[model samples]
Target chain A: MATVSLKNLTKRYGNMEIVHGIDLEIADREFIALVGPSGCGKSTTLRMIAGLEDISGGEIDIGGRKVNDLPPRSRNISMVFQSYALYPHMTVRENLGFSLKIAGATKDEMDRRVAEASAILGLDELLERRPSQLSGGQRQRVAMGRAIVRDPDVFLFDEPLSNLDAKLRTQMRTEIKKLHAKVKSTVIYVTHDQVEAMTLADRIVIMRSGYIEQVGTPDEVFSRPATRFVAGFIGSPPMNLHEATVSDGRLVFSAGDSLPLPGQFKSRTSTGDKVVFGIRPDDFYPTGHGLSSGGETEVHRVELPVSITEPLGNETLVFAEFNGTDWVSRMLNPKPLKAGDRIGMSFDLSRAHLFSAETGKSLRN
Target chain B: MKGFKPSAPFLLLLPAIVVLAAVVVLPLILSLYSSFTPFRLTRPETFYVFVGFRNYLSILSNADFWWAFGRTVLLLTIALNLEMLLGLGLAMLVEKATRGQRILRTLMMFPMMFSPILVGFQFKFMFNDNIGLVNNALQSLGITQDAIPWLIEGHLAFIAIAIAEIWSSTSIFAILILAGLLAMPKEPIEAARVDGCTPWQTFRYVTWPFVMPFAYIAMTIRSLDVARAYDIVKIMTDGGPAGRTELLWTLVGRTAYSDARMGLANAMAYFSILLSIAFTVYFYNKLAAARAQIGAEW
Candidate 1:
């Protein structure tokens, strides 16, 4: 395992820079995920670290050695591509042993290493099969096995599970986590799926456009997002956010509905100050519904019309009209609610987030 | 009642079958029939006279015919190999060209754009002993004192013809192989690089095997093309200066048209077909093997 560090890492295409200079330090044996939408430069940063791409500027050090000028092979890093780029002509055994063969390992040594990798990946049965002969999940495993046999200092995965079906993706997610635990290598995984990042990463690096938005543990970013982008991006059914102005100790929406601002944010804003308010579904509940029985709850009473409800077996997602837009609220335990039914709700002010409208930065600090 | 109606597909295809018989099969049968007889275009009555393999036996024994046959084989082997190698080099270079790659590919195909007859005429004049650009350039450069007899010398004329053949058709290989290269998946190449293979090793173990099927396809097509090649050799040397650069097609053309010996020419044509068959079979098997190696099928 090795610590990988990027010092002001920048990538430029012609005159237009796609990845702005950003610094990140990845600890040894840490699984760091870079997650963002397409064209956000997450993949570019990963490729730069893998040395598959030429960095326009800045420095990348892997295991205390400068690797910016080094070739991918000399950097001692392995990558799993989204396409699972297994050599189509070679059998799984040959594919796994290719790097060792290139490095001039003895035949017995290569065979032993390949065997160990195959066993770890459950690929012993498919060792004689070619890539085309294997199923997609099997091919993905072989691709991982190929990297495992190399025993490189670092592993870089660029959306390796994006091609699999949902069920397979979940299965591979567990497998990858297990593989990391067994291998204990410094891993840099890139994905657009926030759930994957939240589940698998020791720390998630959320990127936008060309810059790193925030880097923190999943729970830290989830509860204490540094930017409005993170507040909206980190959760599923995403955090409900809206533009509003502060008026007489209350946040007034464009549609004229107002809710009391959390007392803590009173000092962060003055009357008529524009701010973006955010709240996660779990933090809001119907007064008599799940988690609303706590006597100490400072629930601000509001009556709103329920618009939609997604019953996902264990929990039902309730969407209700509040401040002119639909706000999703999570209902745990049991509550039968349908569209157009007016329900009395209590806003969880303590969990509310306020961000400066102009800067899109969280105002808590 | 519905099942009893005429089958539309076969009915629609009947005209095609008739046209193929008239344009292809009829002539094929006539040529096969003619090969068995002592036919002559000048003497129409000789069409019916049976010759019973006499043409075949006589030609087999004829040393000059064997020399032309051997020379044709040599030219085919040398020209195809040279063109493939040159084509691979050109395709790789063109693949690497970043800006104006489309224009570069177009320029690479320029030689192939010319008709073979035109290419033959072009090379013939270019190889002329007295005033050809090659000899003139050599003389101007003080590389050779004498005006070299390019077409007059047997080996030199063969080289000249081989050069013409390779120059005109190398693009066929380049275009096909370039297409293969373009269609190649980028991930495997990157994977190979991460697997620690050098550029040459990547090409050898990954790129080359993927490209073999395309190369073999081009080879099969070019083999049939160069087998019955006539116009170029005719224009360049007319298989003359003592039939030095004679290919099978030139020999067949002379016998059938100039000598008016249609029966013997047909017999020789049948023999030449064997060469095409051999090449097509060999390349087809190789192509199949290459496809199997990569687990890809058309």
Candidate 2:
């Protein structure tokens, strides 16, 4: 039973403070991901929880026991490094059984645990090979197998799939999810890839500049981002965010083009209020090629010139010129479009977002 | 037949081959020939008298020669092992220094930069029985009332020579091992800690294996450099009172120069060269095995 908690957790390196006081609580058997851009303190927070880095101004509780001063081994946690840190001198069997050997487990117990982990990771045939002899994917598997053999209360993964090729990364992502299900241990996975966090995690914690921007399930973070940063960060082809001023009933962009203020922020905003407008590529599409079925209210249409089109197999991303910015819009069902062609683009206002220009916070309640 | 013209590659290599034959091969063949003769430097005309196996057979039966041979092997074995251990310890300490690492590494190699002859003199003075720093310090600290005969007694003089040799060469091992430590990735150590290893266990299982190849490389180099200690032993004890610290090279030097028995000296020199070859081959094999373990991982 491992429920990790960080209260007012802070990290400081001499005169510089990289990670400010942040709080998070993780439940038992829950798979959570802490994801952000580089230098956003995501990996640092994970290492702090792993007992690798010292916390400057807070307490860490792992399995209901305060582990602030405890060493990493006593914290009952295992971490798979970004580079699979397999012992090159040892064979796969020895690598898997090293922790058990150090723990003074009997030969039979060590072999049994090693065999179980190897079987789970499909590393049966490669047991006698050294880490130098294994391929990248196989090495990653051995690293995970080593972690599993220890049976720690918590599993910490620091970008375990980032080194793999795209196809292999996808395959390993599924394998990690399966491993988590079978192991049923509390896993805190850290990565910059939002897709990995979205597909694998039960909850996603998006961080920005040492602060957690939002924490929600995949659907919630995607559909209802809490901040403008999250809205732009969580999607591929990214959400189109434009800065504008609220004048009368319309949000007036700097390029003199205007979009109707999203309906949800009507009560939360007023005239002359500087704000940023946001809409996902899915919400802003070619007029007839949108995903929203019929009966959608507050749909604004404008005839705009298609700047570019990126055809991605089934659907294409249409870049339309709006407010002097090339806004990304999705086109469905293979609409034959070209550059400089005028297209009727639709902005689903009901699904749009408005954020305060000052704080970059969402204006919706 | 066409004119026999040398190829460009062979022409380019001619100078090197000529220099090698003149400088290296000629002397080696001459010495080998001399070892089989009963030639004396004083009796120059006796060089033509080849008394086959006389020098070799006499040295084989001489118990003094055998004792010198065995003592030389024992000294090298003990000195090399102690240097490796101390060098490993020193490297680990220097590697742990967070700041001033470059300065520490340079300071660690100060002993290695000193010439072996100079080191022998320095240690000889320090270990002198009557007026030496070691006995003086011991007497000042009230540890001993007598001036210990550091370079006089047989075992004590041997210890003195080993100390001088280790001091002059241990940095070779330390520098190489330190390079290994610096090039090591920090991830494996962190992984080891998380894998429930104590600090000692992490060092034993991870750090040592990673640096083993470097240590073995240093061992191979120093083993082949056994001649460097010859000057040190010659300066400090010179085979001692009653030949207590007599090594093969010391005996060889005395026979060739003092006794003018060039043929016998050449035979003794050949035997010592064989010892160096055996050590080099052994260490080279250990180095290859160590490299096989972790070389590809890097």
Candidate 3:
């Protein structure tokens, strides 16, 4: 295991810069996920760290040794590409043992390590099969197994699960987490799926437009996003952001709706100040509907007509008219409220977030 | 009459069949019939005289005919291998080129665009004993005082013809191999690099194997084309200088036209088919095997 650090790392193609000057430290045996949408430079950063892409202007240190000048083979790192880049001509066993073979390991040792990796990945029965003979999930397992056979200091995965079906992706996500625990190697995984980042990584690095938007644990990033993009991107059903103005101790919306300002931002907001208010679906529930908000939690109750309801087994998602837009709210317990039925909805102000509309920066400490 | 109309599909194919019979099948049958007779182009009435297997037997006993057959096969084997190597190198270099790739690809095909006759004549002058470019360059460089007889010497003429044939046909290998390289999936190559394989090892294990089937296909095509070395050898050395550079085609063409011994030439031509067919079958089987190795059905 080793610590990988990037100092002032920048990547530019001609005049167009893809990864701006960015610095990051990945601790030993830690799993860090670089998560973002497409073209966000997350993959570029991972490729640079793997030595597949040259660094334009900075240094990468692996195990306290600078590696910017080294080729991928000399870097002692393994990568699993999104295409599951298994050799089509090789059997699963040969694919698993390729790195070992290239490193000049004895045949017996190579067989033993391949066997161990296959056993770990549950690929014993499929060892003799070619990649074209296996299913997508099986090929992905072979790709990962190839990386594991080498036991390199770092494992880099570039959206390795993107090619699998949703069910297989979920299964492989857990397999990767378990694999990280068993291998204990420093890992950098890139993905556009926020749920994967939230579930698998020890820390998540959210990127946008060549800049690191935020870096924190999943819970921290989810509960307290640093930017509006992160706030909109991190949650399922997404956070509802409404533009409003601070007017006489209340948030006044353009659509003739108003709510009392949360107490935490009292010193940060003044009258006529424009803000983007963010609230999660789970934060809004029916008053006296399910679990209490807790005695210490302040809840502001207001009556609103429901517009739509999506029923799951345990909870129902309720969408209602708020500030001339349909704001999604969660309804716990059974509620017989139709689309036009009015019910008292609880607003958990302590959990709300406010950002400056002009800067898109959160106004929280 | 309406219900008895000719079958449309058969009607549509009648013209093709007629043209094929007129242009292809008739000549083939005529040639087969002539091989059994003591026929000459100048003696049309001799076509009716059948001397079954006599021409074939006499030619089989002829040592010069056997030598020409053996030499043709040897030239093909050597030239095909060399061209494959040179073509693979050229394709790899072209694939790595970043700018002006279209122009490079176009220029690589210039040799293929020229007729083999032109190539042969061009090389003939280049290999002339006294006024040749090679001898002049050698003389100017003070390497040798004597004018090298590139076309007059036995081995030198063989090498000169081989060089002309290879240069004209090497592009067949390059274009086919380049198609394979273009269609290759890039993931496995990058994976190999990450797996600690050097560039040479990557090419050896990944790129070369993936392109093997294409090379085999090109080999099969070129083997058939190069088996009959007529126009080029006819133009360059005309199988002269003690007939040191004689190939099967040059020998048969001379016997058919100059000697007017059509029966013997046709017998030799039929026998020569075995050599090219043997090469084609071998390469085709290898091509199938290589494709199967990559798990490609087509």
Report the poorest 10 consecutive residues by lDDT, candidate 3 chain B.
Answer: B289-298
Give the C-alpha miss distance for residue A156 in model 2, angstroms.
Answer: 0.5
- Name the runs in model 3 displaced over 4 angstroms: A289-296, A334-337, B1-19
**DockQ of candidate model 3:** 0.81
TM-score of each model, in listed order? 0.95, 0.97, 0.95
- Candidate 1, residue B277: how far the Cα is off, in Å: 0.9
lDDT tens digits by residue: candidate 3, A224-283: 999988999999888889999999889998898999999898899999999999988878
lDDT of 2: 0.91
A145 in model 1: Cα distance from truth in Å? 1.1
Candidate 1's docking class is medium
Q: CAPRI band of model 2? A: high
Error of 3 at A281 (Å): 0.6
Give the C-alpha interface root-mean-square deviation per candidate: 0.7, 0.9, 0.6
Model 1 alpha-carbon miss at residue B104, Å: 2.3
Candidate 2 residue runs with Cα over 4 Å from true position: B1-12
For candidate 3, give the lDDT: 0.91
What residue pairs are clashing in model 2? none
How close to the true structure is residue B76 of candidate 1, measured as C-alpha lDDT? 82
Computed on C-alphas against the true complex, the DockQ of each candidate is 0.77, 0.81, 0.81
Candidate 2: Cα lDDT at B225: 73
